[model samples]
Target: MHNKTKLLIFASLLLAACSTDPMQEIPNRGDSAPEIETSDKICNTSDDAVAGSLIVKFGEEAIPSLEQNALNAAKTRSALTRSGIESVDDILNDLHVTSLERVFPEAGEHEARTRAAGLHRWYVLGFASEEDLDKAAERLADVAEISKVQFRTRLYRASDCKTYPFQATANGQTRALVTADFNDPNLFWQWHYINNADQAVATTSVAGADINVADAWKLTAGNPEVIVAIVDEGVKYTHPDLAANMWINPNPSPEYKNQDIHGWNFAADGPISWGQKGDSGHGTHVAGTVAAVNNNGIGVCGVAGGTGKGDGVRLMSCQIFSGDLTGDALVSSRAVKYAADHGASILQCSWGIKAGIYTSDNMFIKQSPMDYEALQYFAAQKNCEALDGGLIIFSAGNESTAMSGYPAGYRDYISVTSFSPDYLPANYTNYGSGCNIAAPGGETSGLSGGEKAGVLSTLCSETSNGADYGYMQGTSMACPHVSGVAALGLSYALEKGKRYSLDEFKTMLLTSVNEIDSRLGEGSKATIADVSIYRGKMGTGITDAYQLLMQIEGTPCLRVALGEVQLIPLTQHFGQGAEDLTYTDIQMSAKDMEKLGIKAAPKMYNGKLMIKCTKPGSAKIKVSAIAGGTKPGTGVVMGGMVITKEFAVIARSAGAANGGWL
Candidate 1:
């Protein structure tokens, strides 16, 4: 045989080997292979025809090699007779391969290789015809080198419907208001921040119903080191309220050079733009709730927008959804990986698959392996050293059902449900065991006050380069509130030189909530029969910003002996050198002591409170440290400001102890 003919024959054989069913070559391929299935149920939809897309996991093969193998396979399949094809390029013209791209190169080489070994390289392939795409996916599934294969699925934003305009009052009544700062005119209108008892300003305001952001702000508005990634449609980064707190990429590669100044738009595969004309205002509103510039003398106040000193947590716009507010699971996963790889400490996602689309029993049946791997990779990255790991928060969904949606329903993410100003579950908020916590998401209808009480935050004008504000209600709105509160908790932890692992942080958040059912006289109920399937099933309770910070600050818990005299050494609880503090310097209400049935007064005997328990109950006691007499010889006046600590005292009867107590 001629040397040239031998080489050609060898090349054809190599292509044939690459094109054949690789899985058939595996030992016990049938037993080990993942089941490949397709359904008429729409995984994704667009104005164009429903193009068939597949997520293929190429095991042990680099992306470049996988692409070459795919090309060879395409050419071999296109050729009617191997001997008749002249070149790979000639056969390529006969094939209609629309797209074949790596799903998550941004996950980085080392991490992807280490964490997701056989599942490292995920490619999304699109075909012109659904029939052709289905056949291709089946062929890929048969390849031994491929570990997993699934149809690319789609996800939608948790709907945030604006039932009323921004300034429209439910009753059309004008009322007096109080402002946190003279510059922030709209601060008085933010009932979620400070729910004052005044009915005129906040017709629906319930005392202690708010997140208590005002008290948290006094400790530390926010630290600029914290970065939260808003994974939504797109944020109006240029909006005056959000511009200052927008995360600017310090370093950009040649491909993203000068483009990703604010953040990346994963939907467009380019730099971030707010959105084109006729876009929904979801992302901007969500961003504003997270970190709109505070005390700007314009717009509503953000929960953690700082004290107008350029110290707010920065927000990175990870635009997964587009103008039409639609997105696919593949891009959304990439956006998550990008946020984790970048500097974002907290990822606030107000989007998820619709709940009724997949139930818990069949969830894994239709689960996309690509998305599962990407989220797992993200969960492993410790982006926030201060918090011990990265945090991802999601909305529980607005289906008004008991179940949660995907990603949010995933154990790795914190699922937040919505609660109205009346402290009831928002009419549309999903509830069940999956809900990690509840926050004020707001509701505009079905209230006696006719209160259009949806959350108010910064928004963008429908036209021109302008900014506006609006009210939107959903678990979408509630998710960001938790994100902002988590930021505040992180800020407090960092300042206090305390650190918590991701799980520990979640525990703290869960434990810090006020027991709403107990407070509402619905003792021990997991779910509200009127609203949710299971009573008391909502994870932990409603998030309390003040309590979360207090937990981070190492507040002490007091266990009092009922009907007996007990002494709590203040110095032990408050740290050393507390003996110099006096009784008058410590602050506590007589009403609080009365509630606990404790006759207690701050009579410091070596910096300890002398107390007598009159009965058995519980009360929260607040104490403050006063300035110690000037330090000897230094002439330095110390402790001018009062540092307060609230301690929860549980008084138990001495002789009435139950066997369970022992």
Candidate 2:
């Protein structure tokens, strides 16, 4: 909400910049060709498009070399060729075009898929800095070989976001104690993962308003098979908590020797530029939320971080934003394609075009064709065996508007909205039609929790005064939580030997949620929002990790009324034959029992399990029974094979017996 005191407490210090423009190095060969007269037609443009840059798609029938993925072929053979000029290079040379290059690299892993989808035809053309954008576009459009011409537009970037660095002794231990899931001390302050309603965090914090990763951690913390691409700024790969989880390219391009092993820096086309002026580690924070190392007695815990092993989902940094070089369609589109070409199945995109810039997908595609095709290409990729296509998650803009910004508002992908520790929409989070899910992004506006009210994760030591962890808040923070959960869900699916199509998996992800709309009570300390206004606008509800895993496990999620003792029929999970089977025992871990506040020993009665849940959360419990025989048969007796089934017990105030939590 941009509270002044909160800014003073957590805002990142603006780094002094004395850098030169990175775009001046492009070579110009326009002087050697015939000059074309400038056209007077007005440019169909917006303030969002970057100056002096245009993306053009070559027609398949005209420029077959580019359209057919003929990497070594020349652009033109003669001046009378079908392309309207001697070549794309010579033809563009007459129109102030400095350089022309394909947006996607030459014949990579998914080149066939890209070519079939028409993404191979996309090429970026850079013009002289003084060239008029409209005239340049008009001239390019006149070329018969050019199928489409669009201006390069900038994506969202926040180089100076808030940063509250971690300290050794006083910073972490001073907070009131609560059980933490990870050994990292700072995890206690991360109310977004597992809010325990500790007054020390925020007096208004909701008890179960977290992603419910705690219980899911017991089933499967993470699996290394899943990879997520952080398509924002360059990540500090050397950070201790993130280094081990970084994706290693087995066949690294020779140009990227020691550096760029994790992923290439598409922004500068070199090593990750973390030390640049105005760089505030926004990508690092987002990366931490997705796969930061866990239980190593250091930094914060990632949502998919493994149980003290190097088994977390790998993170690949596809940097599109670096310092003053906020991304253009030319660079960012390359990062998206790079993620698909590499082995990333989940794309963690925290940025987008400006809020309200182009609310509809048609407008976005028309204004920025390069980006649209890039995203379309990524969505068609299958990097992991468990999912048919990649999962691309974007943040609903932080503009406090009802309509989420594109490409998050595009509807084809998952758009995340932000919620607070109090379970209300964050003042800056955009909600309504486009938002697909809600997450705890934290809210630190005029609140008593200070930095504790915000989401905490890893940061660059240089940006955070030599500390490698910090706190920040935005829909940017919320998007990664969803990405992390999707990664973990895929990890669990792999463990369970299950597979799903992209659409099938997303339906489970969206349905695996808890109630949020019903919690909009006017409690004075909750929030400044007229939270009731966000009732049905905040997507399905808060995302639940345990519930998603349960969905993946093919286990029935039992809905129980909150704060009440009830009997849940086992038939729903174990089939109708459950009543005929002889039950041996029902078991649950002590931590899980406490997590659900089950004071009574859960026992089987009349083929049903009875228990009381005093709070809201999701937990896993096991039931063992004899399959064939009525009771357990010893060594000499004929008996049924012992069978065990796991069920996800979810407690919520607004759930029904029909299995609908929302």
Candidate of highest lDDT: 2
lDDT tens per residue, model 1, 298-387: 777887788888988899988987765357777787788777777788989998876655566336333544565556655666766578
Q: For residue 5, what is the lDDT in candidate 2?
A: 25
Model 2: per-residue Cα lDDT over 1-662, one tens digit each: 01222211111121111122121111222345333232311123735677767777655444344322222223232111122345554656666555455566553344456556666556676667677777677767665456567777678842127877755445443345446567876677778887767666677666777888877887888899999999988888889999988898887754344365889788788877676787888999999999899888887899998878888999999998887887877788888987888888998999986567777776766666667778877888888989999888999878888888878888788999998877667878888868899987877664567777778899988877887888888899899999999999999999988889999999999999887766654433334436656768889888989889988988878766667678878886678987777889888998878877888878888888888888767777889998887766679988778889877888755433443322
Candidate 2 clashes between residue pairs 3 or more apart in a chain or in different chains: none
Which regions of candidate 2 deviate over 4 angstroms?
1-44, 65-94, 158-160, 168-177, 254-259, 521-527, 561-592, 600-611, 615-617, 621-646, 652-662
